[model samples]
Target: MMELAVVWSVLIAQTMLALAMAFALYRMARGPRAQDRILGLDTLYINAMLMLITFGIRTANTVYFETALIIAVIGFASSIALAKFLMRGEVIE
Candidate 1:
């Protein structure tokens, strides 16, 4: 019964994450300003990472966790680059 409950919870979490990603995508595509689009992209990546972590938990696997960590690192870097570009018109000095 506990296992069944865990499975159902994971399923529900994944479904919600998918819905969040879809909304983020819509914002990314339709945002009127660059900042809004960047925010949407950031949200999308964060949700993807969370979904991966949930998958890892559901499967009791380290591989999914590692992948999620990588995604988080990449997302953080990209968000920084984007913010720098927005402020200075370039990512690197």
Candidate 2:
């Protein structure tokens, strides 16, 4: 009974995350300003990480968790770089 609930919850979470990702993608593509697009990209990365976490929970796999961690690190760095570039017109000094 509890296992069934867990399975259903994970499925629902993944579905929601996927929908959110789609919306984020649309925003990133359609945004008129660079900042808006960057915000959308940030949201996308967060949703993607959560989706991977849900997959790890559903499958009892560590790989998905590790991959999510990698995505987190890379996403954070990239977002920072993008923001800095937008502000200064370059990523590095």
Candidate 3:
């Protein structure tokens, strides 16, 4: 049934997101360089956002979509700051 397929898809997506989050956390903790840590954090953020979207689909609610959008904007800002810091050795300098 279509309903069953949707459920399965949601389940699979959540599982993959969880795994990705775990891996990102590992990288963030173990990265040898600041840039690697920043990249891991970005990946973690994006994966969390996707996980929220999947939750929205499973619950048939729009709130998660808004949350995901906010997360995306915040993630973008964080990545930009990190990149700037890498380039200048200081975020504001």
lDDT of each: 0.96, 0.96, 0.95
Q: Please list the residue runs of candidate 1 whose C-alpha ends up more than 4 Å from where it truly belongs after superposition.
A: none
Candidate 1 per-residue lDDT over residues 1-93, each given as its tens digit: 999999999999999999999999999999989999999999999999999999999999999999999999999999999999999998899
Q: What ranges in model 3 sit over 4 Å off?
A: none
Error of 2 at 64 (Å): 0.7
RMSD of each: 0.8, 0.8, 1.2
Lowest lDDT block of 10, candidate 2: 9-18
Question: Worst lDDT window (10 residues) for model 3?
Answer: 84-93
Q: Residue 80 in candidate 1 has what lDDT?
A: 94
Would you list the rank order by lDDT, best first?
Answer: 1, 2, 3
